[model samples]
Target: MENVMLRDVIVDDLPIFFEQQKDMTANFMAAFTTKDPADKVAFKAHWEKILNNEAIIKKTVIFNEKVAGHVSSFEQFGEREVSYWIGREYWGRGVATKALSQFLDCITIRPLYARAVKDNIASIRVLEKCGFEIKGEDKGYSNARAEEVEEYILKLS
Candidate 1:
């Protein structure tokens, strides 16, 4: 596969973004809570807000010249943190790690935080590979799964 790259999400990319989001939510329903079609619609609306919002930094993750997923950093709980998702079809290919590392390089910030569902070993590994250290854990509601789940927190300093 071609190397993963990150670029600004443009207006024209919304369709791909929406499709990827649906695929990801369906594939990881246990970790997310957007199983219901209505919930998925709401999720898309939320992403629309993120796409237009100036405060959030969102980028499309490209692999082999195709849109694979998205990476972003946004202010939450008083800290600027990073988060990303790679499509199920592209998992285990190092695309997320490379895209995330590149995203972090572009955004200059200290004490960056990331969270992954406790069961998502791959995501945890990606964060670790990118130099993030586990700091703690918390219970949170996941939209795709429709239940509260254990989340592992990682910090980069």
Candidate 2:
């Protein structure tokens, strides 16, 4: 297995994260994303809120000493939820599964939730591998897809 580790997110990691999110394929798979992924100002503002928020548990994912992406847990719609973003280059190397596993160890909250676009089989698989089960479904506007997208809601308890 690759040496996937999760650590505190730093200012330096933001650029890599920004570039990762700009990938069209990733944006499509993620579906519910920023309306403008290329808007650096919005991206910065968003990260500032995440970094400064005391309630959000955010971590940078490192693989072989390089920043691969990030994982975080935060409250959304009054429910604790988890999310992750792995660079396209790191897509199939088990980076997300291992990083999320490490994150779950630190976040003790139960009944955690996660959502993935219905067609994003890879993401759903990662969630399932980490002990999350599909519990419901939802539909929402997706800026990436530029339309309403169906998604699966998964829960870990």
Candidate 3:
């Protein structure tokens, strides 16, 4: 993957990014997602909260100069957690792995954390390749699945 880089997300990127996140397959694989992915008003408000907040680290994942997806980290229950969304078109191209490697370098916070739906082997593999270790498991409500899902928690020190 050439030209894979992480850059500060801009307002113009939100629409594109939100569309990527709204993919039903991607949302199902991720398990946790916005209550209603199609609501532009809600999507805009959500991105606004993320972009305006100083604590969140937001970045656009560029692949060969095209907007491929996004990788970002935010605090959950006082633990910083990694999360990402890859456009369905970009899946299986190693974009997530490459972009994740670069994003980890920019986030220096130690003992970082991440989670993945138990069946999402691809996402778990990306986190593991980046040096995050599976620490435990927990159940959470998945808005996309409309049910509780088993999630694996990982940690990096």
Candidate 4:
């Protein structure tokens, strides 16, 4: 955790992000993800769109000087929301929590929102550690689970 850092996402980080997000277990835990996690073209296009958008605050997560994942805050449903994906190898080591803490420091938007599949206790814990509180519940079609999944809506103000 002490070695975790966040930096502006660069073009070179996309490949690492792609591989990290493609983990079956990681995707399943995330629940809401791109329809085809293995589609390289789609992944590239998605990153391109994100990188081109100045409104999005996206960063590459560096843990022990290696790209562990990515964290981002963007507008969704007319509200600002935060999201992050950490490689499974970095899980259980406080990587998500630390990365998100740093990212939140850069985001000044109040009442920021975040969501996590209800069963993803690790993500929930990370958000809570970053001062987000569960404010509501929602159900959405999860590409990873291929079903309607329940999620928690958390807010940080």
lDDT string for model 4 (1-157, tens) is 3599999999999888988878999999999999999999999999999999999999999999999999999999999999999999999999999999999898889989999999999999999999999999999999999999999999999
Candidate 1 stretches greater than 4 Å from native: 24-30, 33-44
The better-scoring model by lDDT among 3 and 4 is: 4
Point to the candidate with the largest lDDT.
2
TM-score for each of the candidates: 0.87, 0.98, 0.97, 0.98
lDDT of 3 by residue, 6-125 (tens): 899999888898888779999999999989888999999988999899899989998898899899999997899888888989888889999999999989998899999999999999
The number of clashing residue pairs in each candidate reads 8, 0, 0, 0
Better model by lDDT: candidate 1 vs candidate 3:
3
Candidate order, TM-score descending: 2, 4, 3, 1
Candidate models: Cα lDDT each = 0.81, 0.96, 0.91, 0.95
Ranking by lDDT: 2, 4, 3, 1
What is the total number of backbone clashes in candidate 1? 8
Clashing pairs in 4: none
2 or 3, which is superior by lDDT?
2
Comparison by TM-score, 1 against 4, better one: 4
The reply for model 3, stretches above 4 Å from the true place, is none
Query: Model 3 residue 55 lDDT?
Result: 90
